[model samples]
Target: MSVNESNPRQLKLLAAVRERGAATVEELAQLLDVTLQTVRRDVQRLAEAGLLARFHGGVRVPGSTTENIAHGQREALNAEGKSRIARAVAGEVPNGCSLILNVGTTAEAIARALLRHSGLRVITNNLNVAGILAANAQCEVIVAGGTVRSRDRAVVGETAVDFMRQFRVDIAVVGCSGIEADGTVRDFDLREVKVAQAILAQGREVWLAADASKFNRLAMVQLAELSRFDRLFTDAPPPAPFPDLLERAQVRCVVAGADATGDPTP
Candidate 1:
């Protein structure tokens, strides 16, 4: 089934598993206030769609090193978290500055959040991001020239990498398919990785925008190390090792959707 066809319960189920990392059949049933059979059915459907990975008794977010989730599924997954991350990133972005946004659903969300900002120059390799930011009259949107990936309207390859080298931006906002325990950021496509690396090289400061679901997940191509980023914006505090990793890397971690006192919402 398409992501749009997923019911509210299914979405909630996904959120529960995402927040907890994993949940058993009984746990999910109780959390959703549904029968065990119903939860099983939903899990089966979501697992079949590659939105979740099923083990003997529970489900968790998929952890495929060689393949990223489908674009639509990724958009639907952790959507609220992505929005929070976007807002946090946007809050830090100064007006009248130039930035490069790489390809991802989260980057598209950031584009939407940036609509109100004026006198901004935004360069992107994602068509969706370009389209979203195009509505902002005050923001100059530049699209890189390259072969577009039909899956998510991302422009990648050597041409895109070359296109990004033309300017040194104030910040590069990027997302990854996964962040490993060893502090390696990763993605599934080598061409996309190359383009992202180029974008990072051109930025005076680099920021990573990703949801908590990406923690400890796996992806094939090594994008960059966590140390490369100056900041990390996400919805929740990262699990163990990452806090130490970020501290060592000297990357500031900003938890969005936090209370006014600056504590993460429970």
Candidate 2:
């Protein structure tokens, strides 16, 4: 089922599984305050859509390294978390600065959050982001030339990479399909990975905008390492080993809507 067809309960169910890595039918039913039959139905639908994997009596996120979930489903997954991450990233952006926003639903959300900022120049490979920022009169939006992937309206390929190399910007706000346990940031598309790498190289400071769902998730193509980022903006505290990893990498972690201020590492 498409994300549009998924009810609020299904989305909540998905979030719960993501947080815990797996959940039984009884656990989901209790957590969602729904009947066992209802929980089973939701799990079936989500699993059918490749968003979850069904076992004998429970569901877990699908472990697919070569394929990503549908674009629509990804846009709806952990939406509130993505919004919080957007706001936190926007909070750090100054009024006047240049930044490159790469492809992802979170990057599109960040574009919306940046609409009120003035005297900003934004470059993006995602058509959705360019359209959102276009409404902001003060922000100059530049679109990169490349082969557009119709699935997500993302411009990828070597042309996009060459286009990004044309200018160095203040910050690169990037999103990834997954972040592995070994601190590798990954994506499903090699073309997109090349463009993202170019965007990273062109930025004076790089900030990674990802929701908690991305942590420990697996994707096939390696985009970059966690150590490459100057900051990580997320909705909740990262799970075990990440806090220590970020500390060693000197990458400031910002837990949005939390007490930590994510100040620059001295």
Candidate 3:
């Protein structure tokens, strides 16, 4: 369906999310007196615009009048999608391996997969990730301490940079706020970008774990060109020139659809 076909429902869903903070498909279906599938379509459309995040069972109001967003809400959006990416990433690791996971929402999903591995060494600046892995007796988790951003919920600063330099890893699974046709990986904040570069520098194999929303959008800062990546694992195929551009850059673009079990949505 075209944007025009979905715009009205999108706006209504957006308002509903704003008023209630968040709403599940079932709730929206009841409120709008429509099929749950109709609510899903509206949610997917708004999500593509980056106006709202698609959650597991619902959608969250993006940004806010009184406060910024948190990780708790984002974890719901594409829950199965994230899990698919996580299991794929985990499958790449051996029994004893060291890896760097950047502090991004998708990266968080990858971290969850790491929990299933035994005798693993993990490096990250994300306090949430470090805390989550601490419970696994078979895994060793390292934290790069630095100033914390409550709004973004990640640790970043010069201290984090210095800490990252101390170790080398087999893989670095980072996140991108946005990706351009030119294969430039961007992030919303300069501080975050700077830290991501540090993580990339410490690893030989750089695996960027992202969903399809990351494509065609440019974050405020461009940290690395697409050529720097060894593998790009995203949830779906990118629009237009980006796919061609990534190929030209010699970057391996491996697309795993959000619904990996099925083909890409038309």
**All candidates: TM-score:** 0.83, 0.84, 0.73
Candidate 1 error regions (>4 Å): 1-51, 60-63, 258-266
Q: CA lDDT, every prediction?
A: 0.86, 0.86, 0.73
Task: State, as a TM-score between 0 and 1, how close model 2 is to the true structure.
Answer: 0.84
User: What lDDT tens digits, residue by residue, belong to model 3 across residues 1-266?
Assistant: 53423333454565567556688999999988899888888887667655577778998856522232345545654556566667666767777988988787778777777777898999998887887788789999988888998865688988988889888998887987667667788877677778889999989899887766555543468879888888887655556677788778888876664454323222
lDDT of 1 by residue, 1-266 (tens): 44444555775676677667789999999988999999998998778668689999999877666888789888977677777778778878899999999999999989988899999999999999999999999999999999999999999999999999999999999999888889999999999999999999999999999887677767899999999999988877787778999999999998887331223332
Model 2, span 121-158: residue lDDT tens: 99999999999999999999999999999999999999
Q: Which ten residues in a row have the lowest lDDT in candidate 1?
A: 257-266
RMSD of each: 4.2, 4.2, 8.5
Query: So what's the TM-score on candidate 3?
Result: 0.73
Ranking by TM-score: 2, 1, 3
Residue 221, candidate 3: C-alpha displacement in angstroms: 1.0
